[model samples]
Target chain A: MSGPIDFYFDFASPYGYFAAGAIDALGARYQRTVNWHAIVLDANFQSLERIRIPSSVMRSDYIRRDVERVASFMKLPYKAPSSLGLHTELAARLFYWFNDRDPQQSRAFAQAVFKAYFVEDRNIAQLEVLQQLCCPLQMTPDDVASVAGDSATRARLKAEIDMAEARGVFGSPFFIVEGERFWGNDRLPLLERWLDAGTY
Target chain B: MSGPIDFYFDFASPYGYFAAGAIDALGARYQRTVNWHAIVLDANFQSLERIRIPSSVMRSDYIRRDVERVASFMKLPYKAPSSLGLHTELAARLFYWFNDRDPQQSRAFAQAVFKAYFVEDRNIAQLEVLQQLCCPLQMTPDDVASVAGDSATRARLKAEIDMAEARGVFGSPFFIVEGERFWGNDRLPLLERWLDAGTY
Candidate 1:
């Protein structure tokens, strides 16, 4: 009953970055395909009437520390984003635009976006920076701008986020295979075991 | 300079039970002693003005599934407690009362308490239930009743929780070794790595 591993993540989540950092390699090792879906996760939380950990709260301080510590533990380079409450919806729309055409190129764009925000400290919400990052993918500035507000891509992203919420994916880095759901990057090891033994 | 691993937990947290199930063995393998400190964790969250995940929220559904799945992954017997928001402050105070006499016996009592709530679905908040759980350690009902609200034990529990908060221990099953803090039971693997090589 195993099919492609569904990887749901949001661009603004550091843990999602960690999952994106290793999930493909892990899938390859297990001879499984990974379907990367970018979601506007906080919107999904709101739709479900769940509380988002506020950036002004004490847990935010721990989240910042945890992100750095986990990045080190995962051996991924990280610089604390100078800004919080990132407008990552634009990035999510672009992801679907690229994903619709070429999944392979979309993965590369996703990694670059993660590094641009986490490692390079770029404001992804800005149109110019995202367009510059896509230049290497052979897209002109105009092509990137077209997807920013195109009705087609906007509907696509909306449908994807809706389906994810319907499936109960309320956390970043949620994975589903054969109808078994695992949430968080920490659950990756257990997911690996499940893939290996079918049930453990 | 690695010293004993200070383990902070509250009896009500399922993740805390998972940590208790394995932390001591993990410590022994590295030639380290584990200093167990039971804390009233939600009080710390309140003092810090952080939102504790309400068990009635939408996220609570995911938490229930995750707890069951984690219990299976840890290979520990579990039965969802019929009660939520357990009055674990009483249990935390009793832990120190016995700990002052014999740390080993205190540890054994702690395990029994965890099993009573997690596996057997017994209400640990009730004094009659808790006193019976400690009977295996040769503690009579009268001796257990004495510690139920002893001012000495209440102050002792308060001091322990305050010290933990002062050191920034906000999550259950938080560990401190040589001043490096690891929160959540999932972090035990990274904590083990640090114990091995002294910094990855």
Candidate 2:
């Protein structure tokens, strides 16, 4: 229970964005480190042969109303992006790229990407938006292009996806500590309790 | 805000069963009445043409693990039934049947049915099991058979489904307070806050 927490999420997930704000703070309070693993939701399900998440948020009205109210309830800044099917793999690739060099900066970059797409209504699928996001963090466009063009980054993401598959991670905002699995943003209270008591 | 809370849920949903224990207490604390509408998840999605919840809990390992932890987290008694796709419509019919005469008894019967399946590992789909559940409530076998034999109860369930469709309900453990929709058992906290503050 005192062990480090592992977070597995897809960048396209809104709940993942919402959870990004609180996860680090929770880890800090508990004095445990959080390990962020970026995986694609599409890849996770395609492997399981379970239901495929719709490529567009426009396909599900329930998700639209649910996330909007959730943002309001969670007091997080949120605006619906025109398209949800953006460059999740690219964002994740860049995350691993930054993550290898400086994990702290990678966390910052992840937050920026979430904010850009969710709050600012920017299309992160495009390279320019990601480059603009990277600029503030001292990452040059060449750095992004290098990662994008590299087949090695593609292999890195595949390894992450393979790791997720090994762990049976089926949803976003998944948490694992001491072999206990908790899924979805709503389960955080339970995860927090486990962290508090060292067992539930 | 002081208006009655509408709860839409499917009996097959373990979270819905977990939620049943607390919703009444929440409503009573706020001096609000809870109107429980027993919905079948299968029908809800068939109408919407969305993803169908796997008929059997055995079909999905993830849901199985998720609900077991949730039951522990919520401190509710739960035993996985041998089969899940049984008698949801029958249970809904019986609830409405009693609701028309004695709402209190109907609530009690609803609780008993939930316990029979989730806590006792009994099948509510069996007439004998439901009848055994009814005995303590002073409802006789004739009363149960009469409803089962009647086409009226089938129509009654259809009406409930139609109403759910009109309300845009698509999941179990759905709550609507004055047109604000909250989905999932995890969302009860947010729903309670809305009740507490009158608006969030």
Output the number of the lDDT-best candidate: 1
Candidate 1, superposed: residue stretches over 4 Å from native: A44-52, A56-59, B44-51, B57-59
Residue-level lDDT of model 2, residues A1-200, one tens digit each, is 48999998788888888888789989899999999988887753454635234455334776777788778888899999887756588888899998998989989999999999899989877788889999988989998888877999989988988887777776788898888887777788888988998886
Deviation (Å) of B68 in candidate 2: 2.1
Estimate candidate 1's alpha-carbon lDDT, on a 0 to 1 scale. Answer: 0.84
Chain A only: list TM-scores of all candidates.
Answer: 0.93, 0.92
User: Compared to the true structure, candidate 1 yields what TM-score?
Assistant: 0.94
C-alpha lDDT of residue A28 in model 2: 91
Question: Which parts of model 2 have CA positions greater than 4 angstroms off?
Answer: A49-58, B43-45, B49-52, B56-58
DockQ class, candidate 2:
acceptable
- Give per-residue CA lDDT, model 2, range B1-200, as digits (tens): 49899988777778889999889989999999999888876653454635344454335776777788788888888888887756587888888888888888888988998898888889887787878888898989888978866899878888888888778777788898988777788888888888998876
Alpha-carbon RMSD, each predicted model: 2.1, 2.0
State residue B60's C-alpha deviation in candidate 2, in Å: 2.5
